[model samples]
Target chain A: MVRLITHNLLACHVKGCTTNNFPLVFQDVQVELQVAEFNPDFIRNMLSRLEWTALVNAAKQVGDTSLPPEQPDMMDDELLQKLHHVLMEIHVTDGAMVCQNCNHIYPISNGIPNMLLAEHEIG
Target chain B: MIPTPDLSHLTRHDLEQVYDPAEDTFLLLDALEQEAEALRKERPLICLEVGSGSGCVSAFLGKIFGQSSSLYLCTDINKHATRCTLATGKQNKILLDPITCSLAGPLSSRLCHAVDVLLFNPPYVPTDTDEASSAQSSADIAGSWAGGIDGMEITNRLLQDVECLLSPRGRFYLVALKQNDVPSIQSRMLEDFGLTSQVVIERRAGREFLLIIRFARTAHSGSGSTS
Candidate 1:
């Protein structure tokens, strides 16, 4: 599945494009909701590592407006459920991730993202 | 007076004998095993064991999943503990990358790669009022247990840093004593952090208890938010 975590680590592999290659801009995304369990402690621990603004924007693009504009001091079940959905269930089954920096595009098919570079792009 | 079993004899093969299973190890192992099985569904995985003592359990897990290309990272807060644990894992034919560091220590980004499974059998015993009788002498002994006054000391801090290392769909398991204020912990997780939880195991013996907890990946719907 094209998970947000995988999405977070990906960057444009295009040649001569180094700076700001990450936080790939999602375009024409197809979101799929799959049920998963929740672990609050894990999520609490993960808060420090998340890109809140980017995740919220991406989720909004996919019609999921569950996250708060700001992170809450208290992690209530209600907020957790929303965070849970945004982080785990929303799968990008089909779409293209366009790089904000180099404008390089990576395609997603059958839920698997193609992160491979073209023959000439390989270093 | 009958001489207490020699620490050397008790700790012979591994640290497994350091604590009575009924009191500590069994509860933690129960929780670790429960989550380990679920994580195994994604075969050929890499598991991280935080606060791994003597590396016995990780070794056992490595053996079970080693045939399928799984590797275990057994870590501890002290260097000597890591050495001992690594030696045991190696002797038992378990693939392990042993790291010696504190729970709050920094890890290299390479070592912090997205992990499929995270297990913790942290020190969950509260300190006694009598400092003389407390097990807070050695760093290993102190790090091994002494969870503040309530037994959530190290564990509480450890949970906050796990997100950076967790892979998508990664599973987490924590084994804590029945007296460790589970409801408060759950509430803290559900309320303060955005995560869901399930009680996988609970052993009831009058006032005492042991809980096996499992958490979902960070992203998933049903935050039940009012906003």
Candidate 2:
């Protein structure tokens, strides 16, 4: 659940903390790299859906800076391969995804991120 | 028919915490299989399942679309269920990412109108409001079927999000019982969200009359959700 693809989709959902929630700030993460079967089409398709800044910042938070600050205009194989690795292969087995806006912590343990909030925090 | 996902990896202890794949699960699988041809043609990229109990249905979806065509995302309140879902993906050679959270709660905003395929097999058993809320709070096996009021307390929450969740070409598949008032569900989705729907498949399993209803934006939008 710590895959960059999934991380990009997660935002702070705590009660009343709405604005500037996207791109949850990652902190104190233990990263694991597992090779996955790569599909260029999937990468290319996901490219459109990805929040480029969020992904780039998240990749760096987990200690990988290979991704460019901006999405490359060229969708070449070289770029696709890089996107595949950064998005699919990197796994954060332990740590927390802290919300920049609300400071809520979403923990990732044993490779699954617990995004469940407290009852009062659920909105 | 595509073979069901292998669940031999799931142990007895796992079932105690997670909802086991049973009649309702297979019914969702069967409905998905029935829609395989159209689903593939759409070439969907994002597939999300709410309350993915054993991860069986999403694994079957991987087999249908092939492993690399879509990103399979699942959400479950029960921690064991999410872990079981990840294991089932590994067992079946599919990549499934599971998040421990209530039904699509954490995913709603980022996935805004971006989900190509949405699924939910919510707790459809009518129970007391307190029972349902407690089950939801505890986030265990009981949460799988403790539907409050008209067996729709949970499903109703998701209904508010569906209109905004679906991509232009997106389709949502839901599992419900006849007691849930299937007709009213259809009418509300049409009247409120402008989403036209049709019952994809239905079966009477034991005393439960289960149905799979598929919904999408109206046909006049150039994308036909119905075959």
Candidate 3:
């Protein structure tokens, strides 16, 4: 499934589709909320790896506006909990991840994102 | 060797649904341990684990390779396995990206020739074709050990993609049973994909003889051969 953590690292892999490929736009998504055990340290460690702006934007797109627009310097419990929920709880069951640059749509069915491209789209 | 990922967070309830680390899992870990030096030397950028049940193997890999350098991507058809994998990674301080899909379903095309380390400990138990298909479609714990018809049904499908997935210096590790016909698998990969392989480790656990086989492209051969 497309979780924010996984989505954070994904970019449009279409041939010659490089710039502005990140943060694939989620459309018609079916979100399932699962509660994972909260671990502040884990979230704190993940902060450096995350694309903060992209995560907040993606969260907003998925109707989760809990995260602040910018990543706060202080590692507060409130922010960590929000990050945990955004990254771990939310699951995109059904949708298409549309690439911003290529307009290539990678569909998610049965909670699996089909990242495969056409033979011609192979880089 | 890097310590195995801490799975204390996973409860018995969770283990009931997901495939817990067992003999097969440990064999894969040992195989990875055997190749630790070579893997570090190659400096893999991307590591993909197909059917990452319980996430132990991948987490161990992340620990060995260092989390910052490579992207640790994992796939499993079972949703519970994916969740367990995520939790395991978190507990171990490894950033594992677990995707709930069947055998690199969506990742194959994009990851073409980009995966530097590929790992799979598939369902190698012999069973009827229907049972295996049902288990796979159900995406449950049964899918963890219900290989059909000589236990190659699922492995066969993945073997077709190995050549496409591996980078030039890539390494693939597979866990199999004696009944799975290890020799044929190695020969087939060599003939069809030009991939050479050797048995890295083997142990008899009860009636099942488990083997960990390592496969790599012919050009990258002399560095890590453990027959």
Residue-pair clashes per candidate, as listed?
26, 0, 0
Give a tens-digit lDDT track for model 3, residues A1-123. 577877876777777887887778988898988666566665675566568999999998889988888778897888888888998778787888898887889888655576645556756
- CAPRI-style docking class of model 1 based on DockQ: incorrect
> What's the lDDT for residue B55 in model 1?
64
Cα error, residue B142 of model 3, in Å, equals 0.6
Computed on C-alphas against the true complex, the DockQ of each candidate is 0.02, 0.83, 0.11
lDDT of 1 by residue, B119-214 (tens): 787777776534312332344455676677677767887777665565566566777776788777776777655556778887865565767777
TM-score each candidate.
Answer: 0.53, 0.97, 0.71
Deviation of model 1 at A40, angstroms: 35
The most accurate candidate by TM-score is: 2
Per-candidate local distance difference test: 0.60, 0.92, 0.83
Task: Provide the lowest-lDDT 10-residue window in model 3 chain A.
Answer: A110-119
What tens-digit string does per-residue lDDT give for candidate 3 at B1-42?
Answer: 568789999999999999989888988898889889989988
How well is each residue in A7-99 modelled by candidate 1, as lDDT tens digits? 544456566776776677888888887675565554555555566777777777778788888777898888877876777667787888888
As a TM-score, model 1 comes out at 0.53
What ordering of candidates by lDDT runs from best to worst? 2, 3, 1
